[model samples]
Target: MSLFPEDIASAARAIIADYAGKAWMIATAESCTGGLIAGALTDVPGSSAVVDRGFVTYTNEAKMDLIGVQPEVLAQYGAVSRQTALQMAAGALRRSRAHVSVAVTGIAGPGGGSDEKPVGLVHLAARCRDGRLLHREMRYGDLGRDGIRLATVKTALEMLAELG
Candidate 1:
């Protein structure tokens, strides 16, 4: 009955349950997928206990202003790189009270492909208050914009569960 895919739904539920059980809160730093990852987490019935905040940094300025991503970093690595993803995750934790956070930056597009950074190239980073960071880079091929974004959400949720 849910519009979200089964993997996403289950992962969201698991993240909420696990984090809430541990009395831990989560934050999100999102791009490409907009706030879809945060939306998935909030879809759970009692997500409020675990979800502290979500940053929809769709633009470079937002990423810098809201989450403290450095201008030099974006200028050097661009938004969709592992460096930016790590910085975004670290920034989310620094800017919020969450015990853990996940950051996603990607090119979910039908037109943004290039020889190097093609469409569906997503970089995900999860950071814990304990200072542990995990990163995943995925090449989802040309699955179209919606497909790539949804896939990123699913992957981000799974990473949240793992971090939880």
Candidate 2:
């Protein structure tokens, strides 16, 4: 019995398998989900052909320093904002030699709920081919810390699949 959702993992495996023949590379800038997306991708055999790197920028400082999330953006929109997500993806794309990049930042928490940003609020961004960035936001609605992170990872993998 695996701890992760079997079907999502299977789908991720399929996605990577489909892209394995081509010279595709994936880079991840993660926050709420840590490195779960990268874990799922690397689970597949020979994922080195596709997974180039993963950036686990779990803190505001890390998001800024590692993935180039600017201080102004962090101050203006906060660390978990969409603007930060986009910057994180762009930074990952810039830092790594990968063809595609995905960034996730969020408050996957048991208690970090406010009127504007709630516990399950997540922001995701992807940059594909020449630094074009796309964003997604989801309020996962109090699914606990681990649950929200897992959900974010699942969605990130699916978004990566869409890149194919």
TM-score, candidate number 1 = 0.97
What is the lDDT for 139 in model 1?
Answer: 98
lDDT of each: 0.92, 0.86
lDDT score, candidate 2, position 27: 91
Q: What is the lDDT of residue 82 in candidate 1?
A: 97
Q: Where in model 1 is the C-alpha error above 4 Å?
A: none
lDDT of candidate 1 over 1-164, digit per residue (tens): 45688888888888899999999999999999899988888889999998999999999999999999999999999988999999999999999999999999999988877879999899999999997778999999999899999999988887877776
* Cα-based TM-score, every candidate: 0.97, 0.94
Residue 153 lDDT in model 1?
93
Model 2 TM: 0.94
lDDT of 2 by residue, 58-79 (tens): 8899987887889999999998
Candidate 2: stretches off by over 4 Å: 1-3
**All-Cα superposition RMSD per candidate:** 0.9, 1.5
